[model samples]
Target: MLLPFFEWCENTAIGETIRNSLWLFPVIEAVHLLALCLLGGSLLVVDLRMLGVGLKGQRISQVAGYARPFLIGSIVTLVCTGLLLFLSEAVKCYYNTSFWVKITTLPIALLLTFAVRDRFSLRKSFETSAMSRLLGAGSLTLWFVVAAAGRWIGFS
Candidate 1:
């Protein structure tokens, strides 16, 4: 069903231009990676805080709140660049297992990021700490899979 859309995307002018360009692809990929780093770093701080490590001076909620905008911004950047990257090679991605994996996990990661934030920060219950740790671990694991699969797309 979506194959036709992918075909259309690959044939689009933007995709053709990027795919044909020697330098544009690399430059855009670099920006995508930088956005990944920003996303990972911001997530790490909040996850680590939940894990009972790092920034002990600040509350977990504080760390999470601080990282929220970074998360949102980096996500936006990643999605834009990622869409360009995908548009350039939509057919290739359609056949790539790693791309499929990333696609599957990415939405879950996005939902978990915000849902966990709301649950972790807004709750006053004592179990919030344990719950935060659990959610943090899950978020980290899902994101790792997403990142690893994304990287694997280059190799596969």
Candidate 2:
């Protein structure tokens, strides 16, 4: 079932172009990395504020609001470049455990961000709540795992 989709991806013109070009894969990979940096850096700033350790003067909502746009932009860029990169090696990634791990963790991390973490940041009482701190720490940990698994995909 999924095999045909992977085959189609690998045979697509975009995929073929990426696979054939000497610089395209590396360039996309670099873009993906840059997007990852933006996402991670922005998320970290907000998360650290949740943990009550950084941006001491600003409210949680203010800090999170400042980072939200960058976070959203990076997510879009990373997904686009990542999908292109994946198309070039769809069949290989389909069988890669690290790829599966990274894919699985990505949605979980995003859910943590938008569903759990954002709610915590929006609440004025969250600053003193233990659950808020836990969510912040967990969100950071999930994102870290996602990054590690993504890197592991190259080796696996």
Cα lDDT listed for each candidate: 0.87, 0.89
Superposed on all Cα atoms, the candidates' RMSDs to the truth, in angstroms, are 1.7, 1.3
TM-score of each: 0.93, 0.94
Q: On residues 1-156, what C-alpha lDDT tens digit does candidate 1 reach at each position? A: 988999999999999999999999999999999999999999898888777787766777777778888988999999999999999999999999999999999999988877655566535332336777887788889999999999999999
Worst-scoring 10-residue span by lDDT in model 2: 123-132
Off by over 4 Å in 2: none
For candidate 2, what is the total of clashing residue pairs?
A: 0
